[model samples]
Target: MFAGCIDIGGTFTDLILYERGKGLEIMKSPTTPGEFERGFMDVLALAAKSRGLSLGDFLVKLELLVHGTTVSTNALVEGKVAAAGLLCNAGHPDILTLREAPRKRAFLTKIDYPEPYIPRKFTCEVRGRIDAMGNEIEPLVEADVVAAAKHLKTCNVAAVAVSLLWSIVNPKHELRVREILQEELPGIPVTLSHELNPVPREYRRTISTAINASLYPIVGAYVSKLDQALRAAGYKNELLIANCVGGMMPPDEIIARPIYSVMSGPTLAPIAAMQLTTDPNVIVVDMGGTTFDVSALRDRQLVITPEATFGMDMLGIPKIDVRSVGAGGGSIAWVDAGGLIKVGPQSAAAKPGPACYGKGGTEATVTDANVVLGIIDPDYFLGGQMKLDRAKAETAVERFAKKVRLGTVEAAYAIYTTSNHNMIGAVEDITVNEGIDPRDSYLVSGGGATACHIGEMAQILGIKRFMIPRFAAGLSAYGGLISDVRWEEAATLHETHVDFAVERTNALIDRLRARGRAFLDRAGFPRARQRFEYAYQGRYLYQSWDIEVPFTLPGDRLTEADVPRLAAAFHQMHERIYTIKDENDVVEFTTWKVRAVGDTGGADRRGVDLPKQQGAPSPKSRRKVYLGPKQGFLEIPVYQGDGLGSGARIDGPAIIEEPTTTILLLRGQSAVTDAHRNYLVELAG
Candidate 1:
């Protein structure tokens, strides 16, 4: 049998095919912007061609297929999401519009406030009231709900969201309103705040519902079409989609709440890095065509943020803390108004791509600059499947060179250095700013463009050790194939350590455990293959915000004696985060959570390791590359990566050309091939 994984990124679509005995094969195709499904089908066709089988025959042999897409995120970034209407409580209709506080700098006198996800003009208020204790203070007015539905119908809204005041406490009003809306506006999708996010915060719950409703129609139609196509191609099993919470879910489970798919593909990089090295502390950098994403695994554990910002709004969803910047292979380089060259916060994406691609793009990008400097071999790109136009690349860079009054080679060098600077800042934000030193962490490179710049990035950050996987180009897609099934369940339980209600908390945990177990069972995991993790969000008695504290409770219940242990853990964490601890203060717990994890057990890859061999590899050719202005162009040896065996060592300045990626070594850096044929770079002191 066989299994496969596909990831549709902004610039390329990557596919990885895994067979029982043949191991893995990866392929990539340029992403088709408005027709993402076309790019997806194209990759599958490539996989089929490689196997010398018809598309249908190839798909029929596969037992599983996992997908990751950027459709939902792209729609939100371009403001192309569906036009959705909001139904709010009469007195609190402005909850979505009111700003919590300015997110920008405090010293700025004038700042632009972000527009709400749903405009105020589309908001309709119905008479209803629910108190904090799950009590209905005022009766829900059905007539007003019907009137609001008619108003939304006249507006031709594609979807509707119901977010009433205190809906999490008493969802009766929200549920009733949904029924009336369904009856009046038939077939329109509706999202209830309580059903999606049953937490205490009013604005967070309300906005989360609005965003979900807005994404429902777009993501729903996309997955439906893809599912139908897969079925027609002879795929018999369920289609799994990657979620931003570092796991996968079926299309049916995620189509209703597509907000979880915003940053899906980037979350899997850390999981793949863990498998690439034995180091517990790893800094993963994914440099794709349009973006450079940085994520970390500390002590072999993923650091998940309860809330992450998308565009200008904060989403109340669990996400791996990934820091991204517009520094990639296709990042456009331009001269700023201050008469200085600057590399991107803007990208060429896939439609036009870089000038070297010969796709009608006129802008000079990072890839074009690399070509102009002779760093990238035009004839060897994509193993000669796609030839890069070096003359066009020089013409593109010359345009920027004239504006800056510099030579063409100097301008290209500037763009290269500027791009590296942007990527270095991103790594610092996730490492040094967070108190985790980069010098102690092993930097693992991913994406097609990673190997080109990682050595320079590592040198700049003072990192001593770095790793490049054998299949670094498609790390995220590979992660999807090996990832485990995971689901998290949470409940609101407000309690303090002073008079801890052991029984009540135990009951809440039991309910959460049941929910998690049911989900894992439905996902086809037996009890023996399943495990659970526990944690809670809490704060000091007088604190304004809460921090998540992971704990190990005794047995399946919490006793009075365990309260001090939990308190001590919270104090130590608080001191680590804020540099202070308060043992005298009471600890108040707000949200209890249980995360269920199931092993997939399909991680066998005997073909990945190479037989041990000894001998120095010879250079296939030599090319002149521009190192810097001081040392103009120098001849460097280039070796075919596939011909090199285990324990083979190569020193700088040299290039190792793999079929999918290329590695560059500077004057002081050297690389050695490990047992798995992965390159491990050694930096000079």
Candidate 2:
């Protein structure tokens, strides 16, 4: 049997296929945004050919396919989503039009907000009112719902989102509104706030629902088309999709809550680090063609991304905190207006690629800089599957060098260093700014460009060691190989420690667990393999913010004695981070969360090294590389990456060339191959 993972990135589509005893087979293809599903099918075809099996025969033996897609991401960023209408309580249609003020202390009128998802003409008010305590102040008027749905249908709205007052407390009216919408517009998708994100804050929940509903026609269609193709290919398996909440879900769940997939692709690299390494704490850096992202795992849990902006738009979804800087392999390098040199916040993506690719990209990018410096071989690029033009790279850098009064080699060095520093600053924001010392963390670098710069980035920050996997280009896809099916749910209790209701809290948790397990059972996981974790979001009395405290459930029930233990645990956590905690300050709970993971009890995937034992280091050939302006130039040898044996240590001023990546070790640095066929970079004392 076979299982695989596919990740669709901004520039590349990666595939990792795993079979027992045969190990992993990885491949990359250019991402075609015009038809993303076509790119996926193309990769699947390649995987079949590599195994010498026909497409139908290969899929016949496949049991599962896990996919991480950026469809919703591109839809939101490119402003290509479907037109949506909103149906809220009477007189509350203006809630979305009046967006939030700037996060500053005072409101500013000069700020500009993106065009609202639903215009005033498309928003309709229904005759229903529910109070904060789940009481129906005024009964629902069916005629009003019918009128609103009919009006929305006449407007040609593709989807509708139903959000009413106190809907999170009692969703009876919102549920009725959905039924009426289906009755009026039979095929149009409908989203209810309570079904998506049930919380007190209406604005965030409404935005989540609106975004999900708006993308249903687009993302939903693509998913359905892909599912149909898989079945037609003689495949019988579970097709799992990656969501923004750090887990994979079924096709039905994705269409219902597509907003959870906004930043899902970038989040997977961290998951790869979590499963690949034995360390409990690690930092994951992914440098792709267009962007570099930094994410951390303190105890194998993705650091919670605070609710904020998405694709320059004010949107909220449960996302992993992934800090990004526009420094990548294709980041453009140029001479600034002040007669200084600068690297990018701009990128030359796949279509026009980098200057070295001879794809009509005139700008000098980090990839171009590497080619100009002779670190990236023109003839051996991509294992000679594709060739690059060294002349084009030099010409692109020469233009910038002339404007900055420097030589081509000097200009290329500047571009490389500038991009590395840019990534360093991004790493600092996640580590130093968050009160965590970066030196205490192990670094794992992923993506194509990481091999060239991750070592230097870590060394500059006083870091001692870093590791890069052999298949760095497709690390996120490899992460999907080890990922399990996970689902999360949150409910608001808003209870003070002294007056909290333990029985009510227990009942709430029981409901959330049942809801989570139903899907796992449907997915074929037995009750023995299902596990759930419990956590609480708490705050000090009268405080504006809260912190999450995790606790183990004492057998399915939370007892009265557990309250004091929970209070003490919260205080200790607060004190450990903030240096002070008030025992007398009443603590309050805001939300309860449950995360359930259904284990697949998968294949034996714990091996460290490849089946082909690492052989002795063998040099392929030599190249004249510009080590630095200080050293001028050196005729150093380049080694074929696959020929290097484990425990083989190569000193600085050398290069290791692989099919998907390249590693450059500067003077005073060394590279060692671990037993796992990964490289560990160490700085000279």
Candidate 3:
């Protein structure tokens, strides 16, 4: 069976078709942001036409279809979400307004917090109450639900969010309110807190559910349109979507928990990085059109985080624990009012890409700097598919130089260096600052722009080995094909150390497992094919931050001894994370977590090896390329990446050109093709 994967980035939407025996074929199209489905269908049509097959014919042979999108992230960033109304408990109507007291640091003189997603007028209260013990203290009034629904209809809200107190313990009141609203308002979509996130910490859970509700209708409509268009075009494969947790899930499940895809765009590269390297430890540096994401991978797994803040709330979505910085190939470069040059927090998006792209963008960007400094060949970019206007780039760089009070080349170098520093800082934050030793790990660099800056970044971070995959530009789309179908279930049960009972914990785990199994069964996987992992949020008595400890439980049943064993796992994890642990202190289990994964097959299979290189290498041609400060405009050898074979060695400084990407090797480094034909770049110690 064939599989198709697509990833929509800020600049381009990529499509890859993989046949069981024929390997992979790829296509690229500019993303149409006005209507993303247009771009998506356009690329799918192109892929079908390339193989002389109809969409329906292709789908009949297709086993799966996976996609990664940046829509949710962009909507949140640009404030393009649907109008939403919030329904809170009777006494907590002003929860959104109060927020947290320490919105900004106390010492900051000027700090402006962004506005909340929902306005005061749209936030209404309902007469409902639930005690901390999960018992109903007050009944939900039907009149209140009808009134809230009518008020929301008058406000022209596209969706409604119902977040009542203690909904996690008992969703009875919330369910009744939802039923009343549906009967009253027939068409408006509603998001209940219990359905989205049945976790404690009332404020966080409430805000997260509200945000999900706000985006649900908009995202759901978009997905439906895209799916229908593809189906009409003759595609019938299961349309898989990428999640923020670095896994792929069916579109139905994704629609149910849209919060898991808020950072979908950035999570793909780390998974791709892991696939490209054999090293157990490495730092993944993914530099795309708009941002650079640096993350640490240990034992080939991307670090995961349970808490991440988006817009105005702490979303408890399981996500790749990546650290992001605003440095990219398209980052704008300009001089500020103080005569200091700065790289971006602002980007020139795809509409008017970079200044060198000759689209209407006049602002000098990192791409323009690279063009002016001779780091990039003007006529050879994108395999010459898109010719860059070198003169336009030079003019822009000269103008920026005049404004910044520096020479043309000097200004370009400064911008380049500063951008490198910014990325290096991100790497350090994930490594050195977090107590991870840089020497023990290799650096896996991908994304379209990473090849341009990998050498400098590796040098700054003192990392020795670097691996650049065959299709770095399309790595995320590649990752889509290789990830598993996974989901996480969590619950909060406050049990103090003195009162903790093993029986209670086992019962909670049993319930979660059943819930997980039900979800998997709906997705077409049986109980025998599923895998389970367990963890808990525990802390010392009276401690503020809790540590998440993972453990494996017996398949059929669990006993009392599992509690202390689980506690022991927590202590070990605490020591590993913080470098210290107090074994004498009592541990309190606050929350339990279980992750269920249905494997798609592992990636441990070997790759086809390339033939050994012959005696003498034929020089294609020599081009004047810039290496560094001392060696400016040196004539370097360029080789076609596809022509290189296994055991072939190319000494730097050189450039390896491919249809989709370019790899640059600096002086004092050498590139060797491994058994799999993947380039492994090693530097002198």
Which candidate ranks first by lDDT, i.e. highest? 1
Estimated TM-score for each candidate: 0.96, 0.93, 0.94
Candidate ordering by TM-score (highest first): 1, 3, 2
**Clashing pairs for predicted structure model 1, backbone only:** none
- lDDT for model 1 comes to 0.85
Candidate 1 residue-wise lDDT, 1-685, digit = tens: 7787898876889987788876777789889999888899899889889889998998888788888888888887788999999998888777776735526545876656778878888899888698888899989999999988888898889999998887766789999998888899999999998887777777778888888899999999999999998888877876788888777877887898898788788888887787778898899998899899999987787877765776667776657888889998999998778987788879998979999999998999999998988888999997778899999999999998998888999999999989998999999988888787899999888888888788778888998789887778888887788777777787788899988899999999998899889988888889999888898888999787778888996688898999998889899878856779999999999888888877775456423666665667899999999988888999999989888888888888888988778888888888888876788988644
Model 2: CA > 4 A from native: 97-114, 141-143, 306-308, 311-314, 334-342, 572-580, 606-618
Give the number of the best model, judged by TM-score: 1
Candidate 2 collision pairs:
none
Ranking by lDDT: 1, 2, 3
Name the candidate, 2 or 3, with the larger TM-score value: 3
**Model 3: per-residue Cα lDDT over 1-685, one tens digit each:** 6777788866677776677655666677777877888888777777777778876676677677888877777787787888989998888887765655433445876656645557878988889788988898888887888898889989999888888988888889989988888898788888888777776666666777777887887778878887888777667667878888777778888777677778775787787777777788888777777788787777665677666666455664557887777788888887788888888868876779888889888888888888887777778776676788988888888888999788888788888888889888888878887788876898877677778788777777777788877667777777777777778788878775556776777788888878878777877776676887777788888886676766688764556656677668778878867888888788888888777777765352223556787764555777877665787678889888777777778888888776666777888778787765567888844
Q: What is the lDDT of every predicted structure here?
A: 0.85, 0.81, 0.77
Deviation in Å, model 1, residue 118 alpha carbon: 0.6
Q: How close is candidate 2 to the true structure, as a TM-score?
A: 0.93
